[model samples]
Target: MPTLLTRQRWQLLTCLALLLALAAGIGLRAPTPPDEPRFVLAARAMVETGQWLLPHRGSELYAEKPPVFMWIQAATYQVIGNWNLAFLLPSLLAGLATLWLSWDLARRLWNRRIAWWAMLALASCLQFGLMAKRAQIDMVLVALTTLSLWALLRHLLERPNTRLLWVAGFAAGLGTVTKGVGFLPLLVLLPWALWRWKVQLRPGAALPRARSLLWLIPAFLLGTAVWLGPLGIALLNDPSPELQGYARELLFKQTGTRYANAWHHVQPAWYYLQVIATLWLPGSLLLPALLPGWWRRLRRGDSRYWLLLGWALLVLLFFTASPGKREVYIFPMLPALCVAAAPLLPGLLRRPGPRWLLLAYVLVLGAAALGIGAQLLGDGAWAHAQLARRGMPETLLPVLGAWLLGFGIVVLLLAAWLRQRRAGMLAVLTAVLLWNLHGWGLMPALGPYSSSSALMQQVGERIGPSAELGALAWREQNLLQADRPVTDFGFKRPWDEQWHDAGPWLAQAPHNRWLLVLEQAISPCVDRAQAVMIGSANRNRWWLVPGTAWNAACHAELSKDAAAGVDDGD
Candidate 1:
């Protein structure tokens, strides 16, 4: 068995393991909020309307992000004809690509063993696995950035390969289109230039010429033009105020202004330090042993360390300087960090201290899962309250509890069987188990509530076939999950404006029209006596308001209330 598990077989096995872990729940759930539903909604709109250029959330344009990621989702849906799988396919593929890039880059730089370690270390990270499993654009961006960095490193450290440099530049551009941070990989040039200036090169090793580096300009522009060219043409031909505004918002406000003066998600400068320590776990666990080795290599003037570690530091500082901070903002650096740390892991894992720490970490995770499962099964107050707060059905509590308990027992048993010598294997296996449980078990269990599919279905059933449905202050999940066509007032428009418009629309066909309203956005004009209360989903209650529920007498009062509630901010 050991002989059969050669370097190639091990790499192939590792890739398969990652695929199972990441793709476990592809078709089991609908997109849930914070970001998922909005993107999926926009992609669905693109597919339905056949207007692929600009993304829309209900009737309004979604300019908060570029259209590249949504385009991928839309394209995938066109091919596969499955919304669930298509929505998440890009992230899965991107994740696999990212792992391959990390592995291959490490192998080229050092050896296959180091490459395997790099891939495993990265796949075992909490953040990496979390992002890979979601339909978010960050994983795609991470993949692109990793590709760019991998190519650039090869060109800079190994030989003056212009083709690799062009590949790096193009990938960085596509990444920027995915998320504004895509160009981050190009920051490697700064470190590379600094290294060349400061250190002496070997007899045959030489840096690429300045002229060859200039090829990046056209390659980057070509990539950027993939999205920008069409957008610019659309803006010019349409000349609509809305389209023009979208262009400005996406190009400037969402990128430069948001970064320079972030109005939301504002965190202190040291916020990323906390995120790295906690969210980047298991991989981060090796930091104490790896840091000194990294410093020693830096002192010895290793160009590989200079390119990877230096670019990582530049990325850290770039994000740190911004007022706004998110944990995922620094995710693009994880691959490079993993590759840099890979060569040291074998030696570190052989030591007793790191092995003991890995064992303890896994044991603690198993114990926590067991304890929480026990609490839930026992019908503890905290467990019940949590289920109630999330609007999860009480009946599923036992099922969820049993699943967690079983997972904990299996994890503990596996750890005991593997012991400390195979602590790395234990960590990888535990991660796989956790993700599988989350995807196959927990996600599907939570899908009905978390994605608002249950609530939307109820809304559809209550209204019947002949009734028209409209929404005020509706979330993306509400709109996306609706069984029939739903008329939304506007996603970003003020609730008062939506209410004012919705009232008249409901009045137009009094008996046939119904308005689904968010609990907080429901105006005083809505008579609760006539309105039906739909159950909560995504932590917000919903109301199915009939035309008869509208009290026109309260219009003047509602205007005053709306005026009072107005706040000027994004």
Candidate 2:
């Protein structure tokens, strides 16, 4: 009884739901990364104090990223006390928004088949998929970038709606708040390039005339005003100005000097080439072929093609110039790559002869999987050594092996499906979704981190809900996510285990029993206590309670350290 349109709509909906379900399932239970704990700390600070303009770490105003993720995470934390859930949910939702936007963009430029493949391909990617699971700003960056592209394309090809342009600008502003001001300038180039290309050919088909430049004014103000507006007002109103004294330290010193002057870590330019190649599995290589094809169409007045192309290029350029490079920095480009590649998939599938390029990509993916599996399996001439000393059971080994086998099977299946031109939509979608679920979803969960999860759960029970906990010398945020109030005891560099300054707070804590989650090699201050083996006892005990006789020397050492001035107050 369903019409063809209704069927197609239902199919699209089903695919979307499957993608969301996979993302949510994988993300919800996954361990929070080290960086996530920092975000939670910031968010907790935000909620406790109603200063949306300034990002804080406890009482100190922390100058890292703008307050976007902190605000959202804090808001989410208000509903759910679980900081991991708060951080994970917003990013996960952002990823879902990206998928939906990619599908809609692809559908407009190409066919439904390509749209389905594009969305699935994007959702399946290891890097993007993992980002969705992690509580970070990268997912939000991608979502904003994707939405801006969608709006820019709509403006260029369809009607030049003022609302869309303004919205795009606002999204870019929001993205700036989320991350830094990386891709904000690309707004001008996107629609401008489209208009220029159209103008060179014929006047009638061109984008909104030169008068449309008026939109940029409101766009800039609105985009920046969301966060900076409040910041400016706060700075102006301060009687005892904290920002005024450190004006140089806050702005140019941190952003410009940190990257350009090489005050931080630097890698070779070729670093990102390697990052993009393997971070997202085998499909990442497809970008080289996809870029040129998309460019040709874009130059020929295919609005979406060029808009995405511009956005993707801008992201790459932004990160390439940035000295503060990390694997996740290029995340904004993934959705654009998906959009660029999707249009070509149907044609590639319909081709008679087997595409060598496609096979090559699959083989590369398989090789990457094999290499990773080798590293994980541990040291040996054949098997190689990895986390072997952790004494992980042999039963867990097959999880990686099974993943490799599945990757191989998917390559063959996709190749066969492409050759026969059958299950074109369903096959690609299934392959991408499955790959994402396994590679990004299962892989992060099944590693040493999973063992840590077990440890945290046991520790959480012993520590109780109200016990005051502190990370003595641990970097694992997952342990912090356990339902307990945990603080850092300043075990990190420059401030080594400052328990003296932290002593007053420890004494003031409601619970007498202190849980010390120490790193593998380091030993906590000795006394009476039983440790619940979270992952492995020797490996690093979880749910560990320290004795009444805490080490006085350790506290003295921490107190004398110059950097430990903030104490447990920090």
Candidate 3:
């Protein structure tokens, strides 16, 4: 291993390079759908109104998520006076912070080589790398959760300090405010605490005093109250039944209803198994080979390995059991996965053998890259058509060729470097470099298709600043991109009965109003004209302009589509 990569010398430079790559071009493009636009627009609304407690997309209350992440984004926007970097800066900073904390944790638990390798495993991952660069809640939540766990685990390993425990609790509470899964570290702590209490209650077993919980408990409550208190007061002062309903929904329904009986993105228990195997790709491939080593360590009466495994399983199984699932939901456990996997690399690359593990990894990746590159070169339009089917932009087959070629070169270098044990780490470094290049170079090409900004701008030019804009079956990005007051004509959530009463209000709105909509419905829609197909991203096509009328044809067509479950696809 290079001593230069260790904290004693070149480590800071390496970290800076990594951070630069992660933060670079974060502001270069507008956000994409589903999560980013919604959160960013809500933050924009928050900044506009200075109402930090209740979030809004436009005039409607946005109850999908709590406001900790939004608050950071809004503050960033306030300071920068623009939404460009502000929307994604939180995730970037959080991800870099995660990398640093992960390095320190690995250094404490193991050696310098293991620490560097652990951080590389995380930073190089397909899942973690992408999430860190995007404007998403998962990265922030993962960062806070990891920090809380790190503090608590430090106390668990050696120093039995009440202050560390308190910090751990406070961080965990903030994590909760960040996302619903924020307090999961406390689950790991609870078992450890009970085990400690059990052992401490007996005769002295190399330790006599039980850990203090006095400050830890109170700190956690206060951290939660940082947001909850304001939420309650905001609801109390408003006296609106809708706000009260939002309060109840945020507290209870978003937890139980969204988890046990999720309204969207439901998946089977085994979904994460596939996601972890792929998205954590090439890194997680060693899990099968690494398990026996962990088992042996446990058999030798070393509890650390099992503790890490338990923490990982706690995250994995919890999300696995939930009816709602996303690939990013498994991210909070990536730290443990990286740390636990770090030690196996040294043995897996041992020189006494033919280095089968390294060879397999290189060959698999190299071949995969070659296959993609070949396919793109031979059938460029075929790939383009495939992306078109998914409502994605052109694959930029030429750029993909370059990306794959570069990846292949790195894989070849990885194969060559396997002659030396220290060079084994190059595989991970190359992966990270390839991902950074892809993000900085190729991914931005899709921005036109991914963002609604251009369409919004075009419409803004036509309608000017005074006109009211609305969207039916539209995304939040349209609202964020619009300069005028925008209305969400789509039903945000099934519980949002506000849409049920939308007909009269929508019909009564100003005559100069224009609504943007998806192209699939305009055939049956009312008075549709000059409806330009603007762009496509993630299986949806957005249009520049679509007209609406308070006629039976429009209502009948909408009602029929609603009955036919168009909302399910939209």
Winning candidate number (TM-score): 1
lDDT string for model 2 (249-355, tens) is 55566557765764554667767888888886545645665566676787676556656666677667766886667788777778777777877866655654324
**Per-model CA lDDT versus the true structure:** 0.88, 0.61, 0.71
lDDT of 1 by residue, 1-570 (tens): 677668568767877877898999889998987788889999999989999999998998898999999999999999999988898899999999999999999999999889989999998889999999899999999999999899888888778898998898899888888899899988999988888888888788777786788888888877788899899899879999989999999999999999999888899989998999888888777788999999999888889999999999999999999998889999999999999999999999999989888898899989999998898789699988887887778887898898899999999999999989999999999888988888888888888899999999999899898899998878889889998899988877777887778888988888999999877777888888999988888777889999988876676435564534422222
Clashes of 1: 0
Name model 1 segments beyond 4 Å from true.
1-10, 557-570
- Model 2 residue pairs with clashes: 378-384, 378-385, 378-386, 379-384, 379-385, 380-384, 455-534
Residue 62 of model 3 has an lDDT of: 73
Please report the TM-score between candidate 2 and the true structure.
0.75
- Which structure is stronger by TM-score: 2 or 3? 3
Per-candidate alpha-carbon RMSD to the true structure: 1.8, 5.6, 4.0
Give per-residue CA lDDT, model 3, range 27-144, as digits (tens).
6778887688888888988888878888876666777688889999999998988787788888988998898888888888787878887897788777888888889999999888
* Deviation in Å, model 3, residue 237 alpha carbon: 2.9
Q: Which RMSD does model 3 reach against the true structure?
A: 4.0
User: lDDT rank, highest first?
Assistant: 1, 3, 2
Q: Of models 1 and 3, which has the larger TM-score?
A: 1
Candidate 2 accuracy as lDDT: 0.61
